[model samples]
Target: SQQGEEDPQALSIQEGENATMNCSYKTSINNLQWYRQNSGRGLVHLILIRSNEREKHSGRLRVTLDTSKKSSSLLITASRAADTASYFCAVLYMEYGNKLVFGAGTILRVKS
Candidate 1:
């Protein structure tokens, strides 16, 4: 199985709008996570959904996982200009414990 990949390389929207990013993987995973990265900085974990779980939410962010399809999605509601950043989806490889693979990520820009 391969790592995850995000669709729509980039997105631009106005504040208060919603942003959705999709991630697809090729292998079985123990868990899936979403992260946010500011320009020239480290990433911050947004949410994590276990393989057995179908969905999870944190604040204004929502995440869903489909183990059968080996896919996941991240949705940000009422996005603010501060949400402008790159979002990535990571998967915990079941074959290799402690190994986490990250997707290329989707760049989102929210204009005020």
Candidate 2:
């Protein structure tokens, strides 16, 4: 079962702006990964934060995980039109044999 669910199913932003998307999960997770997918294209790995970590960053992307709240948020700074895509949060459950479950995703549209 998919453990994560992203909020604000859709978002629209202007270029150079910042976009934030959040995800909430039901059970515990060993790690949480965020991915981006262009229309009709495969998902691209964005960033991942381990259970022991509170936050992780890569380039203009930042991810924060809160095991106590069972939630996470992804922040994209200085967004560009190229950043337009669907963002998904995948949860890896250690107890489930490291099974990864993905949320429905949040559609992001960055306009120039």
After superposing candidate 1 on the true structure, give the runs of residues whose Cα lies further than 4 Å from its correct spot: none
lDDT of each: 0.92, 0.93
Positional deviation of 80 in candidate 2, in angstroms?
0.2
TM-score of each: 0.95, 0.96
Reference-based TM-score, model 2: 0.96
**Error at 41, model 2, angstroms:** 0.5
Model 1 lDDT tens row, 52-87 = 999998999989998888889999999999999999
Q: For candidate 1, which ten residues in a row score worst on lDDT?
A: 1-10
lDDT of 2 by residue, 14-95 (tens): 9999999999997878899999999999999999899999999999999999999999999999999999999999999877
- The CA lDDT at 35 in model 2 is 93
Query: In order, how many clashes per candidate?
Result: 0, 0
Model 2 bad stretches (over 4 Å): none
